[model samples]
Target: QAIYNIRNNPPQEDGACKLCNHQTIQRADETEEAITNRLEIYNQKTAPLIGYYEKEGLLKNFLSLIASDTIAEIKKSLKV
Candidate 1:
């Protein structure tokens, strides 16, 4: 994957920070409570920095999807 390639030859700005795409492939009805719990744990342990990004207007939330769908979602988010 492109991500793996980038990991092996990382960009200069890539310090201790990580880059990733997080996805959950399930409808609301199919989502489990455990998923919420896991997100809570991640929020507690990993999301404070995201709050900082949000404050800076650099944070974005994308719906889960494949490559084509991801492009569509991005376009939608950008109002393009």
Candidate 2:
């Protein structure tokens, strides 16, 4: 649904849509395949850092389901 909305509502940038005349951001690479590829690359790159940080005792994980819960956990972790 988010992907559909972003693709449909492309009015945050400078260029206008040729058909609808709505302003368009220049991110034509926000397609599903592109996003999937980016996620795969992110996981591949970050997987090793997780173990490295864990070994150094610098890893703090927050798996909260709610955004507010996660924010609270982050603040607690940072002693904010």
Best by lDDT: 2
Highest TM-score against the true fold, candidate: 2
lDDT of 1 by residue, 1-79 (tens): 1232234654335333243433213345334576687888898988798888999998878866588888888898889
lDDT of 2 by residue, 13-64 (tens): 5556656666555365776788899899989997789999999999998898
* Stretch of 10 with least lDDT, candidate 2: 1-10
Per model, how many backbone clashes are there?
0, 0
Colliding residue pairs in candidate 1: none
lDDT of each: 0.62, 0.74
Clash count (model 2, backbone only): 0
